[model samples]
Structure formats: structure tokens, C-alpha cells
Target chain A: MTKVKVAINGYGTIGKRVADAVALQDDMEIIGIAKTRPNFETVMAKDKGFNVYTLADRVGAMEKEGIEVSGTVEEMIKAADVVVDCTPGKVGATNKDLYEKAGIKAIWQGGEAHTLTGCSFNAETNYDEALGKDFVRVVSCNTTGLCRVLSPLDKEFGVKKARVTLLRRAADPGDIKTGPINAIVPNPIKLPSHHGPDVKTVIPNIDIATTAVKLPTTLMHLHTINLELEKECTAEDVESVLAEQSRVRFVGQGITSTAEIMELAKDLGRSRGDMWENCIWNESITMYEGELYFFQAIHQESDVIPENIDAIRAMMELESDASRSIEITNKTMGI
Target chain B: MTKVKVAINGYGTIGKRVADAVALQDDMEIIGIAKTRPNFETVMAKDKGFNVYTLADRVGAMEKEGIEVSGTVEEMIKAADVVVDCTPGKVGATNKDLYEKAGIKAIWQGGEAHTLTGCSFNAETNYDEALGKDFVRVVSCNTTGLCRVLSPLDKEFGVKKARVTLLRRAADPGDIKTGPINAIVPNPIKLPSHHGPDVKTVIPNIDIATTAVKLPTTLMHLHTINLELEKECTAEDVESVLAEQSRVRFVGQGITSTAEIMELAKDLGRSRGDMWENCIWNESITMYEGELYFFQAIHQESDVIPENIDAIRAMMELESDASRSIEITNKTMGI
Candidate 1:
């Protein structure tokens, strides 16, 4: 099988993880990784044997700063079959025109607005919608977490509505600048807080509302979800459905918090201690009458990595089936 | 004002906090605090000038261990106006016979089945229901949290149904034994998990379901609540109602997690960093169509402390009105 050449733009938190995940896939290869600055991550990317590329404008500056670069981002984009844009939110929107001019399939991160890609992608929720698309935006970590659980539940029993409270990590572990030093801050200070609308970009028909609160921790984002189902079901019934999904891992007894889940990822020797699966507490699956409730933890740094890889297969039509693509991604990334 | 004599029958997590809260009330006095062991808590109770009483069976054993005691649990029960049973779960059930025999009004913690007192109490939710009741059970921390928000929402807008996901702290900060060391464990591994039925013991007419999972942290429990309201409301509308309740503290921007809430309590010079109010993230208050959603932190150690104090007021008819009792308790404890 001919390997799909993939280029990653913006080698930051989500970008670097995607680069590593794409490296493990048998059908895809990381052709190059692009960044604007010659920072520590540029050095780390080079050490990982990834061909480092700089933005067209910053190529000279990067080389001047003693950073080795193989080529410019434009060169990488032109060479690859697909360009995954992991740039900062608004920057991804700016790069859309560049990928289009190169006639390359593009995958954008959730940080960008949905209009940038025209569709939000989740392997479990909207794999079919993304198949053969020229551009796809992998949903945010929280959205991916929600879709991973909601898609199955919505399919099995049918969702009347879903309400999710996102206990978000204030900043990424590596991010020391931004805070919530001594408080829980609401980002938008409004209802639905963009997450619910983001979910709709993939599962357009589902009735869902999300409220988010940023917390002090940097480990993981915990989601407490309540889904009102169309039909009455038992907790066992819901648990079994979620367990069948490849991307959903049922965390049973003894593992209590996001800290433990991250520790387990490290103990298992996962790359950067990234837990790609949605860590759903198995015992937390509860159903009363027709209402179902559970708590799941999202590894903010890595959950989207798997989805990005799946989006590559999805956009390329290398795997049109979600389960097959998810299986392959999980097996390769050890999700 | 004639002071109401209150005896606490457990010097553990909930018991210890309630003892200090009772000590703060001008209308109430901590007559005694009972313990079965001569542990650190017993010594701490004595240092706080609370008369330390020993369980009837362990009085001799406690004395032999060089622990000074004021009297036996039996004598404390006879002299007190109300005996608050904060013992271990089943132990409260056993102590019920003693309180009944002594003809003293009794208050039980949520750990004991609601049947022990046949009336679960929350100052904000069922303060009127508990007035003049011989036996009152102060609902669990999580239940008190749900009621603090739900009671007002239900009354103001009429909740059609409420579904709550409780991200529970695995154990108390002082508790070193109970886990989840490395996993998120569901306490009951079943639907509703006793919390829903416990809420019914206080608010019988409201349709609510609760699912609980234990996390590794000892900070506080986070509750993600979804309420299907009877009529459409705005986020501001919901926020205004929650802010009106004395036990519900609206956590606005700059506060991100329970850790910060606890720190704020300490900075405010609260005893043991006790935040008696349910710290609801004001930014998290959201209403879409007719459904309302929000995230709130329940201080598992001290949330029920105020509820216990109000239960004392209700059981004694010293303050039959919940608002009056809650106001007094909040002002006294600086909630």
C-alpha cells in the first residue's frame, strides 16, 4: 500500500502529539513538521527524527537562530497528500487558503472555527461525513470526549437531550502563563459556552447543551455528563454499549481520579503519558427511569491525537468505516 | 436567648466540622462530642474545650488509654436537647434506639439510611418539613449541594426533572484508608446510587436522579447538574435565583476549582477552611431553550455542617423558618 504523506503545521501541544501519532500509523507518514519559532519544541521535534520545516516568513530567522530546517511550510504542504493545520485558533483559518492552493486535503484542529473546514470530524460520531472531504476539523478535546460517549448512547437508546458540565483544566501542563490561580472562572460567562455548538458541527441533529468552568488543575479535564434518553434503560445496558467502542475505555474500580489515569498511562509507557481513550468510570454509568448519567475524564493533551489520525484516514478515504479506522488508530497509538 | 444543648455522637469528618459550627452559634451550645477511640480527634476536641464523651461500650477502654472523658454517651444524650449522630454508617442506625430511649430529638448524617430518621434535612430545601420533627437526618454533602441549587430552581421555575453527575472525592482529607487509589469507582455500581432517593426524603415532589463516582482527590465533590425546567429562562435568571439562597455561593470569574475555593476560605480566615455554601460557578450557569445547566463544588467536609446546624434549629423549633435559620447559621459561621 502506498503510504499517505502527511505534514503537520504548528508544532505545539496538539500539533506535536499529532505528529507522533501519525508516525505510528502504517498507512501514513509524517513528511514534515512546521513551526514559526525556533523554540525548544523545534529541537524536540528534530530529536524525534521528524523533518523540521519553518513557516515561509520565519525560515530565515529559524536557521539564523541555529535551528536546522529541511524546508519551508509551503514546500511541506506542496509535497504532502494532506496537510494537518495545528496552528493557533485564528492562524489555522489563515492557513486554509495555502492548503487549498496546494490542492491538498487538510485537517484542522478544534481551536479553529468550524467554518474554516466546513465540517467538524469525530471518528466515532462523524467519520462517514468526513470521508473524501477535502478538509476536516478534528473537534476539541472536550467535544471529542463528549462525542465518544454520546455517539454510542445516542445510537443505542436515542438521546432526547444531553447536558454536560466541563470542569476544564485552566491551562496545559506546559503552559505556566495563563491561570486560574485561586478561582474557577467561566470562560464565556454565557450558556452553552461554544462546546455544545461545536458538537453540533458533527452530530447536527442531537439536542445538547454544555456549560464549562475552568479549574486550577493542569492534568486532565473532567466531564460530568447527564443524558436524558428517549427510552428507559439500565446502567448495565449503557455500560455495555460504551465498552464496545474502541476509543472508549471503561475505567473500573480502584482508579479514582484524572491523576491516577495519567499515572496509568505513564506506567503503561504511553508516549508522553497520553491516554487517547476517553476514560469513563465504569461504575459511574447510572440510569434512573430514562435519564442516564456518568463522569468521564479527557486527557486534554492527547485525546485529539487519535481523532486527527482518524481524520487523515477519513479525508483520504483510506478507511471509510469508523470502527475499522478507530481500531487501527487505537492499535497503532496504543489508545 | 436560651441556648439549645447539642451533643455530637461522632468526632470524625462530618462530626468534627458540625461540632465547630455548633460552637459558633449563639443560640446553640456543643454539650459534648462522643468518640469510640482515644485518637487524635478526641484530643483535638478536648483542646477546643468541647467536653469529650466516650461511647458507652468504650468508656473504660478510652479511660485506660489515658483519654479524659466528661461522661458516657448515654448521659450526654439524656442531658442534650438534640443528639446529632455522625457516627459511621450503620452505627447511626444502632444509636437511634439509644436516642429514642432517652426521649431526645436526634439528627443523623446522610451516611445512615434516611429511614433512620425518616426525614432527610437541607436548610434551603426542606427546612419547613423538618420543623418540630423529633428525628432529622441532615442529607449528605452531595445531597445538600443538589438541594441548595435545586430547591431554589424548582421553586422559582419548577424543575420538570433533574439529572446530576456527582464527581465525589474518594475519601475525606483526614482519611488515609479508603480509596480509589488509581481509579474512578462507582460507590454502588448501580443507577441513582441512593442519592436520588435520599433527595426524595427531603424534596419528595421533585423528580431527580443522581449518579456518583469517587475520584482520587480529597478536596471536594464537583456536581454537574442538568435541570429540565418547565419554562424557558436565561442564564442570568438562573444565576439570580441561586445567588438568592444563603447556602448557595455563586463563584464568579477568577475562581477555577475547589482548591481555589478552599484557599479563599482560608484567606477569609474560616475555621478549617470550611466553605459552608455550595460554591456554584456563576459563569457555568446556562440555559438553552428550557434546560438549565451549571457546575458547582460541594465542600464534602463542611457543606453539611450548616445543614446539621439548621437541622438542630428545625428539630428544636428554635428557628422554624429555613431562611432565618440559614441566615443565622451563615452569619455565625461566616459562610
Candidate 2:
């Protein structure tokens, strides 16, 4: 079988992780990775043996750093079977023309709005919809994590309504700039923050309302979910159903905070201490008056990495089944 | 009539404004102000002709700064009939003993939990409840702003339920350390953030839920409120009701953002550009499907200043009616 050639644009947090995960897949080969700057990330990418590509203006900077530049981003996209546009939030829209010119399938990350692709993809929920599609978007990290649990829970217990409070990390750990170092801030200050609507793009029928706040920590995004189940169920029933889902972990062994969860990820020898699963606190699971309550920590940096891999497979028609795609991606990445 | 001797403990943001507001009131006398540091704020306090007091340990810092130190916080509290503990959060809980021992009534700011005083205050709703009370806690800035509008709306239209989304400032403008300089963060990541319960402390029967997120701005907190009214009302009726409120202003005439509201406050030549009113966007007021919707900006620094003044009057029994105290406080501060 011919390997699916994947070109990753933007070699920062999500881009770097997705590149590594794609490299591990048996049916995929990374053509090149794009970087806007010749920072330490590019040095690390080169050390990892991934070809570094830059914009025409930034090529001088990359060569100045003694890093080999394969070609411009436009040239990189032209060579790949699929281009994963991980450029920052709205930059994906501007890059759409290049992908269309290349005439190859492209995948965009959650940063771009759903209208850019018209179809949002989550391996567990909407992989089939993305099969053989020319363009698809992997929903954001938070939305991806939400779908991992809510979709399965809805199918199993039938969700009447879902309310989520996201205690979001101020920034990724490596990020030194972004912060409200000693404050708790409400993000949108608008009811049903966009997360709920973003989730609907993937799980359209799921009724979920999300409220989020940014605190002083840069560890992981902790979600406090309260779901009103249509069918009566016990905590054990909910636990078993969630446990059966991939990329969802029941974490409880004196692991009380998001800090400890990150420590666990590092101790587990995971790459870059990346937690690719929804780390749900086992002790927090509760069944009260037909409503299920639980807390889950989503590593904002890497939770969506696997979804990006599966999205690539689905878009390339390399994998017909989502579960098979997820299985293959997980085994290859050691997730 | 004897003046109410008011001592402000913690001469920072709220404390300084409260001191100015108190000095304006005919029935109140500023005994002194407390400061933990000899910062520029304390310098301003001295320049404003207010006496400054520090802790016994912090006396040297004040002396070194060449600012006159009146006495210790303990000594300041003893001289006053009522003490407003404007110290940072949790610090007020410790200061409660100082007020109790000094045999003076104390008013704590919203930073302290409602349980700290058992009686939470919003002058518009709970002034009578605070009458002659030895210990009363004033709710936070956001809660005070909510009460200013919600209480009057509930009385006029009979609110069934209220939902609010808070777009909170990461920090006050003077704060240089706190930030998420380029990101929006969910402050608590929990449903029905504490603001809702804080509001209940004032309007105990009203059902309200709040979700908040913090952004990079430090201008003011903007709230999007949705209320389900028991009685049907049009946008015009809701507008008229809020328009008549003492500390709530209908902001229009091309005022589109919180920064603009702050600009308006500064242009009005208000002290410190502090807006003590709930600057509601008149254009945002909407009545749809038996619910009222609008956006209001809460000046986190000054919205609670007027409430602190009213709390002192209520606690001192200087004013018998809530409206009388609110009127006196508003007129004195030019709110």
C-alpha cells in the first residue's frame, strides 16, 4: 500500500505533536513541516529528522540557523497527499487557496471555524462523514475531549442536557508570556461560551452548554461536567461506559489536581509529558438525581493529536472504520 | 447628629475609593486609612489629606517613604465607629477579630466569602438587613453590579430565572504582573461560578446563574445578562426601569466597548476614571420570548465603592431607609 504523504504547516505545539504521531502511523509519511520562525522548535524538528520548510520571507532565517530548508510552504503542500494546516487560528482561511491550488486533500485544526471546511471531524463521532472528503477540520482540543466522553455517554445513557464548566489553563507550560498569574477571569463573559457550539459542530444533536474561566495554572484544562441523563444510571454504569472509550482515562490514586496529572504524564514517560487522553478523576464521578457529575482534565496541547491522525486517515481513505483508525493510530503512537 | 467615624483598612483600589466616597458623605468622618505598604497609592492617600496607618511591622516602610504614619491598623480601628476591611481576600477573615475586639462594627469587601460575615450586603437589596449590624460583608464588584440591575428588574417584572456571562478583566490597570496578554481564559472552570451564590446572599430568592471568563484587558468587567421574567415586559419597559436606577446608567451615543465606557468615565472627569455605575448598553436591551437581554459593564474598581459607603451608613444606623442611604451615597459620590 502506498503511504499517505502528510505535510504539516506550523511546527509549534499542535503541529509538532501531530507530525510525530503521523510519523508513527504505518500508512503515513510526513513530507515536511512548516515553521514561521527558526526558533528552538525548528532546531528540535530538524533533530527529529523531519524536513523543515518555511515561508519565502522566512527561508533566510532558517538557513541562518544552519537548518536545511526543503522548500517554501507552497512547495511542501504541492508534494503532499494531504496538508494539515495547523497555522494559528484564522491563518487556515488564508491558506485554503493554496490547498485548493495543490488540488490535494487538506485538514485544518480546531483553530479555524467550522465554516472553513463545512464539516467538522471527530474520529469517534464523525469519521465517516470525513471519509474521502477533500477538507475536514479536527475540532479543538476541548471540543475533541468533550466528544470523547459526551458522544459515548449520549449513545449509552441518552443525554437530556449537558452543562460544563471549564477551568482552563492560562497557557501551555512552555509558554512564558500568556497569563493572569494570580487571577481567575471569565473568558467570553457571554452565556454558553463557544465551546458548546463548537461541540455541536461534531456531535450536532448533543445538548451541551459550556462556561469557561482562565485561572493561574498552565497545566491542563479541567472540565466539570454535569449531565442530565434521560435514562437512569448509576456512577458505575457511567464509569464503565466512559472507560470503554479510547483516549479517556479514569485517574484516581491520590491524584487530586491537574498538577499531579501532569506529573503522572511525565512519570509515565509519555512524550513531552503529553497526555493524549481525557484524564477523568475517578472519585469525582457522581450520580445525583438523574444527573451525572464528573471532572476531567484535558491536556490542551496534545489531546487532539490522535484525532488529527485519524482525520488524516479518514480524509486519505486509508482507513474505512473510525475504531480501526483510532486503534491503528493509538498502537502506532503508544497512546 | 454625630458623624459616623469610618476607618478604611487596606488603602488600595477599593479602600482608596471608599475613603474618597466616605469623605464626601456629610454623615461620615474619615478617622484614618490602613496600608500594608508605602506604595504610590499610600502617597496619594497622604496627598489627598487622609491620615495613613500601617501595621506595627510596616511603620518603617511608611517612615522611609516620608509619608506621615498616623498609627497602626489596630489603633485606627479602635478610633472608628465602623471599620471597612478592604484588605485582600482571606485577610479580612483574620481582621474580623480586630474589629470584634475593638468593639467596632466592621464592613468587609466582596473578596471575603459570604460566610465570613454571615450577612452579605448589596445596598439596594439588603441595606435594611445590615442596619446596626456589628459585622456585614459587602458582595464583590460583579455581585454589586448585578444587584443594582437585577433587584430593580425583579421587582418591576418579576424575574423567574437569571443567567449571566461575565467577561472579566484579567487585572486592574495598575497591575503589571497579572495577565493572559493574548488569550481568553475561563476563570473557575466550574458551573454556576460563585458570583451567582454571592448575588443570592443579597437577593436570596432570585434564581441566577453566572459563568465567567478572563481576557487580556484591564478596563472593566462586562456582563451579558439574560433574565426570564414572570410578567411579560417589552424592551422599552425594561429600559425605563433600569434607567431610573440610582447607580445604573444607560450608555449609548456610540459607546460600543468597555474601553469606551472607561474613556467616557475619564472624560466625565470622574476621580481616577472610576465608573461607579452599571454602564448598560442601551442598544443591547432586548425582549425576546419573555426574556430580557442586555450587556452591562461593571467597573470592578469603583462599582463596589458606593456600596461600601451605604453599608457603613446602614451598619451605623445613620440612615433608616435603603433608598435614602443609596441616594445620599450616590449624590455624595456623583454616581
Candidate 3:
């Protein structure tokens, strides 16, 4: 089978991780990476043997900075079968017309509004929805983390409602400028943060409400979740379902925090100490009076990497079975 | 006003903080602090002018270690108006018979089973239940934190049910031996971790379920709470209620994590950087579709201090009004 040509637009946090993951897949090829500047990331992308494409107007500036460029983003888009847009929030919406004009399918990040793609994708939740679709928006790190757990719970127990409080990292570790240096800030200062609504785009019927606060830590985002089930169940019953999921890892006894999990990932020789699986402390899974509660940590930089790869297979119709695609993506990326 | 003589048993963690808070109260006097051994904490207690007493059998050993003993635990109990039993876990149960034999009213920590005391105390929730009681158990740091928020929510909006996930601290900062060094561990490993039932001890009528996971930090415990209200309310409405309560401190923007909260406490010159208030990030308080949600940090080491003081006031019948007692405790302890 011929490899599906893939172009990653926006070479930053999500984009870089997704590019590495896409390169690892046997069924996918990295046609190029698009960047707006000739920064260190562009040089690193070039060093990784990925062709670096700049914006059509920025190519000259990139070349002036002594960084070699393969072509413009337009050229890369035209050459690739599908493009994954990992640009900063809202930028993807602007790039939609360009991808549509090129007649190439595209994948957008969670930062992009869901309306930009009309369909939000999560491999575990709504993989089939992306099949044969022209564009798909992979939900944010927090939303993807939620779907990984909620999808299975909804399927097995039937969710009545879900309330999630997201303890978000202030900024990506690599980004030095973003705050909150000394305070926890609520992103929206409103009820039902955009995350729950984002999830609805993928699973329309589930009732979820989310409130988010940004913490000063950059290691990972912690989610405290409570799901009201359709019927009564034991903590063990809920654990059994979460334990069986491929993307969900039950962190038992010894592993305590996201810091320890990250250390374990490094010790396991994972690239950049990235843990692609949602680390849900097994002991934390509790069921009481018809509700399921648990605490899970998400590696913001890498948890969505596998989802992006799954989305690629989804958009191109390269794999009809989500499980099969997820399995392949997980195995290839060492998730 | 004649000051109530208070004996603090167990001179570590909660015991130490309770002793300090009790000392701050104009109506209470720390008669002595009980310690099994002459450790550094015992020395520190003595340096603070607290009368340090050792177990009868360890009195000689304590004296030999250059620690001056004011009296034996038995003598301290017999002389005090009320003995606060801060002994570790099940040990409190063993000491209960001693307190009863001495005819001294006693207060126990949350670690002790609620059955041991017959009355569990959260000043805001059950100050009246504790009034004139021979024995009272102050709920755990986590439960104390929950009650501070839930008591108000239940009173104003009428809570139908509450689900809380406690992100607990692995150990108190001063303790070197306690974990979890590298992982998040769920204590009890069962549904409705003892916390929910513990809360029932304070507010018997409110429906609440709690699950707890100990993270790798000793700074503080974070609670993600969802309360299902009997009627609809807005986030601002819920914030207004929490703000009116003295123990619930609304942490607005610019204060990001527990680490920062601790820093602010230090900047404010709090002893040991203790924050008695439940630091609820104001912006995090949100209500959606008749359900309320928010994130709050509990300074595990110090939050229960004020509750312990209030417990003493209630047990002695010195303060019949819960609000009045809470106000005095909070004002005196710099909560």
C-alpha cells in the first residue's frame, strides 16, 4: 500500500509532536512542514529531515535567515493529499479557504473553532465521523483527554451528565512568554468553559459541563472529573472499562503525580519524555451512589499527537476501523 | 472572661497548627502539648512558650533529651478544660478512653473514625451539634475544605448532591518520610473515599460523595467540586454566596496555583505560611444548567486549625453562634 502523503502546517508544540508521530506511521509520509518564521523550530524540522515550507511571502525572509526552505505552504498543500493545521488558535480558520481551494483535506487543532471544520474528531469518540470528510478538527488537549475517558464510560454505563474542572498548565514549557506567573486564572470566567461545548461537537448527545483554571505548572494538566451514570455501578466496574481502553493507562500504586509519570516516560526512553496515554491513577477511580469519579493527568504536548495521526487516517479513509487505526497509531508512536 | 484551658495531644501536623490557633484565641489558653517523644517538633513547641508534656513513660526520656516537660499527658488531660486529640489515625481511639477517664471533653482529628467521637465538627456546618458535646472530631483537611464551600451552597441554593475529587498533598512539607515521591495514589482505593462519609458527620442532611488522590506535592490539596443544586443559579450568584462566607477566600486573577497562594500567605507574614481559608479561585466558580462547579485549594496543614479552635469553643459552649465563633476564630488566626 502506498503511504498517504501528509503535510503538517504550523510547526510548534502540537505541530512538532504530530509531525514526529505522523513520520512514525508506516502508512503515512511527511511531505513537508510549514512555518511562518525561520526560528530554531524551523531549523530543527529541517534537521529532522522534514522539508520546511514557509508562508508564500515569508520564504524570502526565511532564506535570509540562512535557513533553507523546500517551498511555500501553498506549494506543500498542493503536493500533499492532506494537511494537518497545528497553527495557533484562530489562524486555522483563516487557512481553511486555502486548503479548500487546493482540494486537499485538512486537520485543525483544538485551538481552532469547531465551526472552522464543522466536525471535531477524537479517535476514541467519533473516528467514523471523520471518514471521507474534507476537514477534521482534533479537539484540544483537555477535550481529547476528556473524550478518552468519557467515550468509554458513555458507551458502557450511559452518562447522565459530566462535570469536569480542568487544572490547566499556565503555558507549554517551551513557551516562555505566556503567564500565569503567580496566579490561577479562569480562561473564560464563565460557566461551561468552551471545552464541554467542544466535546459536544464530537459526541452531540453527552451532557458535560466544564470549568477551567490555569495553574502555574507546565508539566501537565490535571482533570478532576465526575460523571453521573444512567444507572448504578461499582468503582470496580468503572475501573474495568477504563482499564481495557487502549489509550487510557491506569496508574497504579507507586506512580503519584504527573511529575512522576513524566519521569517514568523518560526512564522508559520515550522521546522528549512524552506520555501519549492519559494517565489515570487507578486507585483514584471511585464510584459512589451512581456516580463515577477519577483524577487523570494529560501531557498537553503529546496526548493529542496520536489523535492527530488517527485523524489523518480518518480524513483520507485509509482505515475504516477506529480501533485498528488507533492500535496502529499507538504501536507506531510507542504510546 | 475566663480563658478555657486547652490541652493539645499529638504535637505534629494538625496538632501543632491547632495549638497555635488555640493560642491566638483570646478565650482559650494552650495548657500544654503532648508528645510521645522529644523530637524537634517538641523543641519547637517549647520555643514557642508552649508547655510541652510527654507520655508518663517517656517523661524521663524527654527530660534526658534536654526537653523540659510541663506535665504528663494524663496530668495535662486532668487539668485542661478540653483536650484536643490530634494523635495519629487509630491511635486517637486508644487515647479516647484516657480523656474520658480524666473527665475532659476531647476533640479528635479527621483521621480518627467519626464513630470514635459520635460528633464530627465543621464549624460552619455543625457548630450547634458540637455545642456542649463531650467529644467531637474535626473533619479531615479535605472535608473541612469541602464543608466550607458546600455549607454555603447547600444553605443558599439547596444542594441536591455533591461530587468532589480531592487532589491531596502527598505529605506535609516538614515531614521527610511521607510520600508519594513519584506517583498519585488513591487512599482507601474505594468509592466515596472516607471523605464523603466524613462530611456526612458534619452536615448529615447534605448528599455528598468524595474521592481522593494524593499528588507529589506538599504545598496544598486542590478540590474540584460539582454540586447539583435543587434550583437554577448563575456563576455570579454562587460566587456571591461563597464570598460572603468568611472561611472561603475567593482567589481572583493573578494568583494561579497553590504555590502562589502559599507565597501570598508568606507575604502576608502568616505563621508557617499557613492559610486557614479555603482559597477558591474566584474566576473558577461557575454554575451551569442548575449545577455549580469550581476549583479550590486547601492548605492541608493549616485549614483545619480554625475548625479545631471553633470545635473547642463549641465543646465548651463558649460560642453558641457558629457564625460568631467562626468570625472570632478567623479574625484571631488571621484566616
**RMSD value for candidate 2:** 5.3
Per residue, candidate 2 scores C-alpha lDDT tens digits across B1-335 of: 78989999998888988998889989998999999998899999999898999999999988988988999988998899999988898888998777888899999988898888889998888789999899999898999899989999999988897777677887898999986664444445534467888899899998876656665678888776777799887889988998898888987776656766888999999999999999887776776445576778888999988888888888888888999988888787877
TM-score of the candidate numbered 3? 0.85
Q: Per-residue lDDT for A1-335 in model 3, tens only?
A: 99999999999988888889888988989999999988899899989999999887998999999999899899999999999998998988899899999999999989888888898999999999999899899998888999899889899989998888777777777878986554435556555688888888888999988877665567888887888898678888988998899988877656656777888889989988998899988777766566677888899998889999999998898999999999999889876
Q: Mind giving the per-residue lDDT tens digits that candidate 2 earns over A141-247? A: 89998999999999998988777767677788788998665444455544447898999999888877675666566778877677889998899999899889878
DockQ of each: 0.27, 0.08, 0.26
Sequence-dependent TM-score of model 1: 0.83
* Correct interface contacts retained, every candidate: 0.37, 0.00, 0.31
Error of 3 at A155 (Å): 4.6
Native contacts retained by model 2, as a fraction? 0.00
Deviation (Å) of B45 in candidate 2: 4.9
Which whole-number lDDT from 0 to 100 does residue A105 have in model 3? Answer: 93
lDDT of 1 at A161: 83
lDDT of 3 by residue, B87-185 (tens): 898999999789888999999898888888788888888889989999898888888998888888888889998877677777778878986554435
> Candidate 1, residues B1-116: lDDT per residue as tens digits?
88999999989988898898899899999999999889888889988999989867888888887888899999899889999888988878888788889999999888888877
